[model samples]
Target: MNSMPYIDQKGRVYKYGEFFPPELSPFAYNETIAQEYFPLTKEQAQEQGYSWKDPEPRNYEIQIKNNQIPDHIKDVGD
Candidate 1:
């Protein structure tokens, strides 16, 4: 079982084992890609139409506040 850090539904980090599929390991292991592609928290991910089981869980509010989400993304929902 591989050990990795995962963001929970509450935006909390947790240690997960055997949670991801082997085929997706490359994307999962890439920290840069993870930060860019995945949501940093579960709540934000859910708002973006991703399920709880999705690996990417980021807070869009935080991203917007921090100016992480691009103008295009900001325009889409609002």
Candidate 2:
């Protein structure tokens, strides 16, 4: 696992084992990028009008199979 801090294009910082996959483009893996773009917290991301998707639990599969969509996506049309 990489121990360096990385920032995504949208300025979200993935510290150490934050588990961000590549191919997201412009993946910043150093302090320089963080200083230049200013990594954002989840709340800050929202305040800046960027959409952030939080991960669901592994049980989400069971919930969906039971026709129980999570509240966050409850209103999403099928």
Candidate 3:
């Protein structure tokens, strides 16, 4: 980590800029920016051995749900 070449999948991600592959990210693949651009279903993400999380529907009167929003801005309405 210091000056030595890190062996793949050997170092702990203790700091920012240190990262694992998309499949290894602690956050669900569906929750990552990759999902925002290259969308994938729960099945698709899991089939690739990537993490997937089914978020619990919140109980707020009104919530800004970033998850499961429309891919196209045109589809969004007030």
The lDDT leader among the candidates is 3
The better-scoring model by TM-score among 1 and 3 is 3
Model 3 — TM-score against the truth?
0.46
RMSD of each: 16.5, 15.6, 11.7
Query: Could you estimate the TM-score for every candidate?
Result: 0.21, 0.26, 0.46
Rank ordering of all candidates by TM-score, starting from the highest: 3, 2, 1
| Tens digit per residue, CA lDDT, model 1, 1-78 | 125576555465445553543233443323345546654565654453344444577656543454655567556654
Score candidate 2 by TM-score against the native: 0.26
Worst 10 residues of 2 by lDDT: 23-32
Model with the higher lDDT, candidate 1 or 2 = 2
- State the weakest 10-residue window (summed lDDT) of model 3: 5-14
Clashing pairs in 2: none
Candidate 3 residue spans exceeding 4 A from truth: 1-23, 61-78
lDDT of 3 by residue, 1-78 (tens): 555533434343334356545555678887779999989888887766678888899887756667868999998898
